[model samples]
Target: MRVPTPRLSIPDEPSLALPRSFWKEFARKNWDREPRLFRGLFQAHFPTLEEMFAALVDASERCLRGEIPPMRAVRLYVEHEDGPGGIPYYSMLFPLNRNHLPVREDGNAHAYLERVTRWLGGKRFGVILNRAQCHHWGHWLQMRSFLSGFYETVGVPLAGADSAVFFGNYRYTPFGIHKDDWHIFYFVVEGKKTISLWPFEALSQREEVPKEPGFIHRAGAIHLRDKAEEERLLSQAQLLEGRAGDLMYWPDSYWHRAEPSEGLAVSASLGVAFRPPEFVGAVAPDGWPDRVRHTELPGGRDWRMPATLRTALQQRMGRKSLLALERERTTEWVRLLASGAMEGAAPVLTEAPLSPHEWLLGSPARPLVSFPLPEAQVLVSANGHSRAIPAPPAVRRRLEGLVERLNSGAPQQVEALEEAFFTRLTARAFSRRAFRELLDELVRWRAVRRCEPPASQRR
Candidate 1:
């Protein structure tokens, strides 16, 4: 007689989807890749995932005082942009609310606003969210309580010793394949996430994937290795069918995706973020278990850059500056385009246009016209060769003059600037996209400010 396979039962009330052993199978195949302290720590149940969701809602509510501070920063990713963009991609980022979000309408949401701002400023851009202002506070509290139990359940501490700020993230939409560098705990408060795992070592040997929209399509067409290795890696891959009260523990460098199937779905998650330890060893020391110490800093600092070219460069070009520069630049660029300076232009496919005017002069003769941005450098010679250029003395002088005018603070004659810049080049030179990027960079660096032009200059 044939025996029936156990149907994965989900409770009518809030509950977890699978048994602890299922996750245990996943940990066995992947644990060796994690730090020793985190090995064998993948138990599926804890403060059940439902409880964790409750805690998160509770914390957000408690933190909400009257008149919530304006969301200091917010990053929005709509379904249209990221859905099939290739392995969890993001399009736009607003590191500061001034450039992106509307003014704060309520006072109670202050603490939530503050913590989110800190996270965005710190560059944790891809954290999931069900909505910007979730209305359920009790749900938040339950989520937090579950996290406390998670710490108790797992003997090894997942978060760093000094880290005080707890991070909460919820996955609403299905995320494509991706990986993160930090250590994270994912509690499924509601709905289900069927995750697929890979060795990550796979990505290391194969070619690196590009973030561009078109490039990813090309890569997928040429390299289709998923099927051959799916059985080996995916077979051992554990599915954390998280229901209302289930939590999935993943160590640092875990490569996985949260996939949604056909069903009504909702889930709350929390990521208690901390820095990685400074040193690596087969075994962790008492004080350095996960490796780093984190501390909650006092009230948020004004990382927003003040406008001054010198200070702007120092901050914009520095290692520490977050998205501040990028946002500022984007805002200013928008303003420039609105002024009609860069009309009917296409972004240069190569390194920055040799001359601002050259963009307006998109000529076929200047085939060496393309230059690669830092991220696009590999592709520069991939098609095989770099081109040679020979500019006459008059052309060189004019180009130099164009750069000086652009860098100058004085007002420019828009038409004149265009002609001088584009005169020698072909007509297809100007690009709205490139102009926007330059303006964004300028605004980010504080070289330009956003607001109405002075009345005297408006006409």
Candidate 2:
């Protein structure tokens, strides 16, 4: 029997603002073609508005505390007249230290925000936190979980995907009007925001103003300051508005800029780095040794091939003798899909190993990505990690059933699970010790987490 390549299984109850009508329209006419707004679908899925605001502040405070690990990119914006752009100014909001890193003072968010206000003489400020999918923070996890339904609806992107938070009170986007390389989905978690969009063929395009000295991000932007130019561009824009709990979709081909309604706001932007299908799929090895195998004698400047090699392309290209390479690639692709893999790699967090007694563990916010192999093994992927466990046919069925239950987001007693294992493997070679090891490894992989202590341990 041949096993087919696996695809991600969408959860029975998705966590996004997906309605049947929206999905139908998007799948039919709107997706990757034009901008459209879906109203009030994301309301029930996100945290409360107040809580969302607090999380942003806390993340900002952590950034100031230098607690942020290597981030993909964090853009802090404080709109003013000092930026290089003609009318609206947008630049990095955080003050930098001598080493050119954003600096923070020993203060809470209130104090920090107050200090910023005073320093800028009451200017508005905004910050963008790039979300890493596997981050332990509640908001980041929720956002990632919410977007999984999206990936399920639209096929997963191939090139790469990423997310970022947009928080600000600027009337106009300080960054100026520009186009992006990736299609964008914006979830309005806070106040209202509108985007003024124009077609890619808007004009011959103008050069962007040079960035302020010592400021980062001198991205290309279209000039709209000239009286005639401003009128022409404004006349052509297709304004799209989104309030709290709403979502907006726009293609990567449109030139766009933010046009906030008023006051403070925050939104989450998911970018699917969509690339043409022809460029996607597993790639071959590119190490120096592998490169030498294809190396030619260069028109008679011949030298013998290097010696220390046994089958120079072992499990690499996997086209010839390296049959295992294809299997590994399949396994890896399944695992990455299971973890909602994006451009940024997920980080493994710390978890204490499971002990030798009855314990409770359950931690899966969504469905598990798993496949049953012909070799009496079950491949399970959770939270961007995977493992294949060997068992008898009967045991494999039971194990897969157990994984499905865990995906329901409920904790089960390890003692009870062990009892089942004991019953199934009574005369088999598998042991209780091996079962415990498997559970502990799953915990370490962030696949499942430990529930709070049982009543007996509370004493």
Index of the highest-TM-score prediction: 2
Q: What is the lDDT of residue 339 in candidate 1?
A: 15
Model 1 — TM-score against the truth? 0.32
Model 1 scores worst on lDDT over the 10 consecutive residues at: 291-300
Q: What's the TM-score of every candidate structure? A: 0.32, 0.64
- lDDT score for residue 411 of model 2: 58
**Local accuracy by lDDT, each model:** 0.32, 0.56
Across residues 69-137, which tens digit of lDDT does each residue of candidate 2 receive?
A: 434245566777654334656667445332222223423334444555566677777666665333334
How does candidate 2 fare on TM-score?
0.64
Q: Which pairs clash in the backbone of model 2?
A: 339-384
Candidate 1 residue-wise lDDT, 1-459, digit = tens: 011122112222222223445445545664434422122233443333333333334323323432233232123432322333232333444333332222233222233434554645532222233321122322322332233233333322223221011122323222345555434455433445555555444443445554454231121211334445434555655455555444455554455655534332334433432322222223323332231111110001111212232243344445534344443332332222111111111111223322332212111101111111121121110001221112334433443354344333334444456555556665344443443454333333222223333345565
